[model samples]
Target: MTKPKISIVIPTYNRADLIAESLESILGQTFDSWECIIIDDNSNDNTIEIVTPFLKDKRFKFTTKPLGYAKGANASRNYGLELSQGKYIYWLDSDDIIHPLTFELCINEFSWNIIDFCRFQRTVFFDNFDVKCFDNYNIDENVFFIDKSHIEKIINNELPINTCSVIWKKKSLGFEKFSNELLYAEEWEYYSRLVSNGLKGININKVLIYARKHSCSQTHEFNCNNYIRVEAKKEAALLIVKNLAAKKMLTYSLKRYFICLSIGFKEYNLFEQIISTIQISSVEKIKWQIFYTILPLRLSLYKIKKAIKM
Candidate 1:
C-alpha cells in the first residue's frame, strides 16, 4: 500500500455524537491521498462505538492514548504525530468540520515544499447552524509567507491561528511536540517555537474550516477566575519568553511579557507568581503592578460591553 501524502490527526474525548460528522467531513475531502488518525483520550462515552463504522475504510485508523502519556488534546496530538506516516500533518479537533476542498487547496500551496506550513481562515458556527463569527486571521492576501517578524503579531492576538487551520510539513516539525502541560495557549507556544526555529509558512486569506462553537467547548469550561487556565497561559508565556530570549529577538521585552501576564490577571493572587516568573526591571515591575491594580475595573467594563453586544 502507498503511504498517504497527508495525515489528519484528531484528538477526541467523549465526543461520541460529534465525532461522526468530523469523520464524514474528512471522508468527503476532494484529496484522496490522506489518512485519518483518531487518538481517543480514554473517552468513557460511545466514542469508540461511534467511530467503528468509519474503520471499514482503510484510510481511517484509531488508537487509544498510550499509557503514561499526559491526558489532554496536546498529548493525544503528539502521540498521533508519532504514528503519522504522511508528508504533511493536520491537527484537527473532533468537533470541527473541514471544507471538502481544504486539504486540496492547502496541499496545492506548496511549490517544491518552499512553505513549511499553510494556515487558512476559519468560520465559527453555533449549534442552531447560525454563523457566530468569522476569524480571518487578519490575513489580507490570498496567500502570504510568514516569518519570525510576524511572531509579535501572533502573540499579541493581532493574528488568530487555530489548530485546525494549519497544515504542517512533517520534515519541518522534526520531533517537535506541543507543550503537554499547557492547557491554554498551547498553539501559541508551539507556533512560537516553530517560527523561532526558522520554519516559514503561508497564510491563505480564506476560511477553509468550520469551527463549531458550543457551550461544552474547552474554552467555555474556563473563565477568567479559572486558576489552572491562567497558570497554563503563564507557563506558555514564560516558554515563549525563553525561546525569544534564546533567539536574541529584542521583542522579548519586559513590557511584552507584562502584556502576556495581563491576560491571566483576574485577581491579585497571581501577581506574585507573574512577577517571580518574569524578569523585569524594578521600574517595569512597578508599572505592571499599577496595571494589575486597574485590571479588574477594566475587565468589568469589557464584560459589560460584551454582554451588551451579545
Candidate 2:
C-alpha cells in the first residue's frame, strides 16, 4: 500500500448536518495525495451516517471513541494522531469548511524541522463569507512575519495561534490532555507545551481557513451558562506557568512577573504579592503594553455592584 502524504483528522460529535460541507471541501482539495481520518467520538446523532458515504473513498476511514462525548477537538485530534499513517497532519473541525487550496498551500510550505509549522490566517465566516485579514486590506506595507523564536514568545505566555487555523506537525503536538481536566484553554494548554519545545511555523497571511460561527460551535455558539469555561482558561494558564517554573523550563522578568500575577487574579487565585516570586524570569518581548488598561477597573466596579445586589 502506498503511504499517504497527509492525514486529515476530522473529529465529530453530533455535527451531522455540517460535516458534509467540510468533507466536500476536503474532497475538492487540489492536492490528491491526502487521506481523511474522521473520528466519530461516539456521537449519538447521525454524524456516522453523514460520514458513511465518504468512507467509500479508499483514502477515507473512520474511528469511534466513547470518551469524546462532547468530543472536544483535541480528543479527536489525539485519536487521529494514534491512527494516522501520513507524514503530515491536518485537523479540520467537523462543522467548519476550508478553502479548496488550503491543504495544497500548506504542503508547499511544509517543514518538519521543529522550527516551522505551516500557518495561514483565517477569515471568520458569519452569516456569509465576509473576509477580514490581519492587515485588513493594506497588504503591501502593513504585515507581520515572525521567525520561530518570535512565534515561540507569544505561545510562551498567551495563546497566539488558533488551533483550527493551521495544520501541525504531529511530532511536536505533545500535550497533557484534550479537555485539560478543566473547561476552556485546552488549545492554549497544548500550544504552550509546543512552544516551549521550540516548535517552528510559517505564517502565509492569506486567508485559507474559514472559521464558521453558528448556533452550536464550542467557543461561542454554545450557550455559556456560567463562566466555567473562561475560568478554566484562566486556571489552565496558571497551571502552564506553574508547570514550566517547577520544571525550570522557563525564565521570567519583572514586568512579566506582574502580568503573571494579574492572570492569577483573573484565574481566581490569590492576588497577593507572594505570587510575584513565582515568575520565571526572561528578557522583555519588545516591552509589553496593555492596550485596554481600563478593563480590570471596569470589571472590579461591576463585580462590586453585583456583590452589593446579592
- Report lDDT (CA) for all predictions: 0.81, 0.64
The number of the candidate with the highest lDDT is 1
Q: Which stretches of candidate 1 lie over 4 Å from their true place?
A: 128-141, 250-254, 260-310
The TM-scores of all predictions, comma-separated, are 0.85, 0.73
Worst 10 residues of 1 by lDDT: 128-137
lDDT per residue (tens digit) for residues 1-310 in model 2: 5898888888788888788878888887888888899888677889888888898898889888555344466667777777888877787887777777787877876743533467667667775543232225332322344343553355554326666776776665655345525556666666555655566676676777778887666667214634666566556666666656655654445235445445435435433332443552333222332312454676789999999999
Candidate 2 error regions (>4 Å):
66-71, 111-115, 128-148, 151-159, 174-182, 221-225, 243-267, 270-310
Error of 2 at 231 (Å): 3.1
Whole-model alpha-carbon lDDT for candidate 1:
0.81
TM-score winner? 1
- Tell me how candidate 2 scores on lDDT: 0.64
